[model samples]
Structures are given as C-alpha cells and as structure tokens.
Target: MKPRKQTRTISRIMVPTDFSPGSAEAFEYAIALAKRLKADLILAHVIEPFPYNLVEGMAFSDYGDRLTPPVQRLLDHQSKRAIKEKIPVKTRLIEGAPFREIIKMAKRERADLIVMGTHGRTGIDHLLAGSVAEKVVRLSPCPVLTVRSVPAASKPGSGKARSKSKGRKANVLKDKATLI
Candidate 1:
C-alpha cells in the first residue's frame, strides 16, 4: 500500500479578491487559515482591462480609471485589518485578466495555498474568462481552498446546519481539485 504523502509546509497563502461579499468571506477564511498556519497572507485583486479598448473619438477610455481606485481601497482595507492583527500581509493589484493574473501571481510568489471566492460578478462584456475562482482552481500550481457559498436559509447558528456541520465551518467547502 502507498503511504499518504503529506503536503508542503505552507509559508504563503494567496487570496484573490473581487471585493464581493463572498470574496470577503473567503478573505476571512484565508486570514483564519494564515493565522493558524503562521503563514503570510497575500490579498490579490486583478484589474482586468476594458473590452473594446478604445473609443473612436476619445482615443482613450475612463473605464478602467473609474474602476481601479475603489477596488484598491477594498484591498487596502483588508490588508490594513490583517496587519493590525499582527499578521504579515501583502497586497498585489495587477492589471490583466483576473484568472491569468492570479495564477501567475501564485506561481511567482510560490504560494503554498490559493484561497478564493466562488461566484463573483462578471466583467468587461462578460468575457469568456468567467468566474475567476473557477479558472484559478483549474490552473493554480498549489492547493486551492474555496469557501463555498452558504445556503440562503442557513444562518450561522441554525439548528439544521449546526447538526450537520458537526462544528465544521458554517460556510460549505467546494473544493476544486484540478491541477494544471
């Protein structure tokens, strides 16, 4: 019989955030995991470029201009909170397709874990690059821990959930096992 191989010691955790409530919840999960593992947490947000890049007369566009700041603010807020808690935190906001940027960042940073949100709003004409979380899971170089969507009826302390979870986290785990 083959022995069950152990995973690598986690030193860095990459969390890709789209600033949605689900991603925020995922951040909470990542932060908790990082805290427990004594690993550095990286908050990554990808600024996907505008589709149909230019306007005939405009020569340029304000599409991305209006978008970047608010997302950066979200990233900063999360990073600040983690740092305040004495956690080693880093944040990266890159301009590119969300999935590609996330996967590249994970590889470059050598992240031991990639924690991401499941469903998020689509972007730039709803490009085929749908659901950044799904793509990352398909392409990530390391383990991906997805914080699954919570059912609308299952509040934190509901008796139905409390019984089934057996003290597991209230949020479901939609583990994506693709290793590309």
Candidate 2:
C-alpha cells in the first residue's frame, strides 16, 4: 500500500465575511478546520466604497456610520464564537472593494488558506457587479475556499422554531447586512 502523500499544513486561515448565510456557513467550516489543524483564524469585513463613488453628498464619516454597524455586529459575533471555541482569532475592518480587501487581508496575515462565501449572484447582477469570491479565487496569494450559501429551505433556522440567530448581531437586515 502506498503511503498517503503529504500536503501543506494550514497555519493561519483568513475569512472575509459579508454576514450573509453563505458567509455564516463558511465560518462554520473554517472554525472546524481551524480546530482540527490548530490554526489561527482571521475574520475580516470590508465596507465597500459607495458604488460609483456617487456618495451624492454623503460625508465619509456618515457613510462609515451607515455601513459599519452591521459589519461590526457580524464580526464581533464571529470573533466571540472563535474565542469561545478556543480558536486563536483576529479581526480586521477596512473600507474598500470586497475582493481586494479580502486578498489584502490574506497577504497581510500571511494566511495559509481563505474560507469565504459566494453569493452566487448571476445574470444581470453578475454582469454588472461581478463576483467578489471569484475575484478572490483568481488573485489570492493563498489557496481559497469558496462556500455557496445553501438554499433557504436548508438554511439555519429555516425549519426550526427560530432560525440560528447571530443573537444580538442578527439585529441588522439582509441585502447589505454587514460590513466594515
């Protein structure tokens, strides 16, 4: 019998989340992987510059105020989870394009892997906006793991009395749920 070939061992994992269900699922996977590998995890969220820089008179501070709460909630919730689980964790918040910021975080952290979610936006949406996860995969210095969100039917809290809530962090609405 041939011995199993050795591959890379993960040391640090970077996860850039938008606080979507897909991102939540990716967090679960990353936590499990980090636990097994004894790897550190970095959670990052990006506050995307207002589309088209068309701030339309919005002040940068005001824009930040509008954009940061949700992202902060999500990041804080996930950070707590990692800490509770005893996974070494760090968090970062930045304002920029999602893919670029995610890649930058991975490089800055020297991450061995990145686990994140793909919203699977398609058709006009994909054409007009493009996919952040796709860009990350293409440009990431480390290996990327993209997790697609499950359907609503299979999503957490879907069939349950209550959906899996990020607790207080679940206060924000979806659409542009959370960011840095």
Candidate 3:
C-alpha cells in the first residue's frame, strides 16, 4: 500500500496595520487574497498603552470617567466597520509593540501567513528607523508578505520622473514584481 500524502492548507491570514496609506493598501490586498483563498482574515491594530506617569497622575474618578468602556467601544466599532461586508474576518486590538502584538496574535490564532506593509524609507530614514515588517519577517513563525506602495510617478508613465529601476533600494523587501 502507498503511504498517505498530507497537504498543507492556508486556513488563516494575519494582517497588521498602523493605519497608514501603505497599510491600507495592504489591507485591501489581504481582503482580496482572503476571498480568493477562502481563508479567514484577521485585521489587527495595536494601541500602545499610555505612559506610566500619565496613568499614575490620573485620579480614580478621572480614570473611571476618561478610560475603559469608551476606548473599548471605539476599538470594537472600528474593528466592526473594517470587517463589515468583507470576507470572513476577525478583528483584534491589542496593547504592545506592533510587531510583538502581531506575532503574538498570529500564534494565538494559529495563522498560516502574515501580510504587512513597509514604509520604504531610505538613507538616514532607513538607517535610523528600521521597519516593523523587516523585524516581523525575521521573527515570525509564519511566512511574511511585505508590500511596498508604488510611487505615483512609477504608475505607467509620468514623463519627467526617472525610474530608479536598477539601483539598490532600501525598505523594499524583495522586488516590486513580488507584489503582483
């Protein structure tokens, strides 16, 4: 008798967003991919907690009045709105570093892949500020798909705009071809 062969299925996909234009593009791409693959999509955002001193200075009355329920409600509403009329999606709002929260959520949900955006910074910007997508790609248990927003001039022909099609580009993981 022949041995049974096992096939892997991509059941879930995790998408982490910072709400930037690049992230929004990634969200749209994730939605399309999720629909095509028949996979569950998780749309997540991380709200870093208020600084310790800020929290410490607040009085109990102020804390009760200003915090808790309202924030939870707002997150819930945003998540619902983002998911509405879309493919099967589960939304989450977590507290921590964005990359950490993303990885943690992916593990918790047992996601098969993660899709995110890169800011495409260069020179001092790229050196001084690293990317969360880069870090996540290195550390994530699942495969990471990093999407780069196409420059306005690069879309078809913008005439005067020269294409940097050959040189080394930072913040772009892999190549522009990977996006399609």
Candidate 4:
C-alpha cells in the first residue's frame, strides 16, 4: 500500500503591512503562498491611536481623516499586485495597537494563516522596541509565519559581505517562534 500525503486547507491568508521593507518582503511571500494554495489574501494595515486628543486644548477631529488616505493608497497598491496575479484579496484598515488589531482581524476573518514581517532587532534594540510579529505569533488564533528582510549583502550581485553575527544573537530575533 502507498502512503498518503496530508494537506492543510487554507482559505484565507492574513498579511499585515506597516510599509517597511520587512513588511514588503512578507507581503510578497504571502502572495506566493496565496497563489500556491489558491487562497484569498487579507491585507491589513493598522493606524495607532494618536497620543493625545488635543494639542494645547485644540481638538483635532480630522486626525484619522488626514492619516487614512495615504495609507489607503498604499494598501490599494499592494492589493493590486495580488489582483494582477489573479489572487483574490481584501483590504482592512483598523485603528488600534498593531499586534492586537492583527490578531483580532485574523480571528474575525477566520484566516487559516497569518504571515507578517519582523525587523530582526536584537539585544537592547529588541528589548526596547518590542516586536509586533512576535506578539502576533504568540497570540494569533491561527498559525503565523514571520518573514525577515533579506540582508542586502546576501542578495545576488551585491558585493557586500554577509555578517556572521546573526548566529550569535538571541534566536528570537533570528527566528521568533522557535526561539521562544
């Protein structure tokens, strides 16, 4: 008798982007996965709440209004790429802490997987600047994949030397879920 192959069905894939290079890389990764799995992409961007409602007691009701258009344009541009590849996608713009919102979005959309980017900050940097990707991986309702930006030196045609230092750092920055 022949052994059977097991497969997991992924109907929706949630990808959160902050417009950073790492985020862009993750988006591309998610695109490929969506194509391969014949799944829909859910592109999400979160806008953090403003620190204060008023500056010198001057209320700013248009804060969200002013911030949303530009971000929406970027999100639209990303979605178009998936559309060009014939992958279905939807965009979500939410206001809240990024990691929390991403988790909530994934649950609400019933996504099978969440793919996002990590900056790979280490040591003091990682401690001070907590990772959103890390939090999502820990809290997400579904599986989460964190993609890191490819170092420029590691790319083909780049003469820069690849650093060996990564092997020495806390593996969490190197590979979030496994390290934890």
Top TM-score hit: 4
Q: Pick the candidate with the highest lDDT.
A: 4
Each model's lDDT: 0.75, 0.78, 0.68, 0.80
Residue-wise lDDT of candidate 3 within 46-68, one digit each (tens)? 77655453567776456434654
> Which residue segments of model 1 deviate by more than 4 Å?
1-6, 53-62, 120-129, 151-180
TM-score of each: 0.73, 0.77, 0.68, 0.80
Candidate ranking under lDDT, highest first, comes to 4, 2, 1, 3
lDDT: worst 10-residue window of model 1:
170-179
In the range 1-180, model 1's lDDT, one tens digit per residue, is: 999998789889998888876777677777767777888999999887867756564433576677778878888988986786677998898888888999899999999999877753458634764667777778889988877555546556767764774323323332422123
Give one digit per residue, the lDDT tens place, for model 4 in 22-73. Answer: 8876777777778878999999999987788855654566677778999999
Q: Which 10 residues in a row give candidate 4 its minimum summed lDDT?
A: 165-174
Give Cα distance to truth, residue 68, candidate 3, Å: 8.1
Candidate 3: list runs displaced more than 4 Å: 1-7, 50-86, 157-180
Clashing pairs in 3: none
Better of 2 and 4 by lDDT: 4
Cα displacement (angstroms), candidate 3, residue 165, comes to: 23
List, residue by residue over 64-155, the lDDT tens digit for candidate 2.
67877777887888799889879999989899888888888888889999988888788999999899988988898988877677577754
Measured over all alpha carbons after superposition, the RMSD of each candidate to the real structure, in angstroms, is 5.6, 7.0, 7.5, 6.6
Off by over 4 Å in 4: 1-7, 53-60, 159-180
Q: How far is candidate 2 from the true structure (C-alpha RMSD, Å)?
A: 7.0
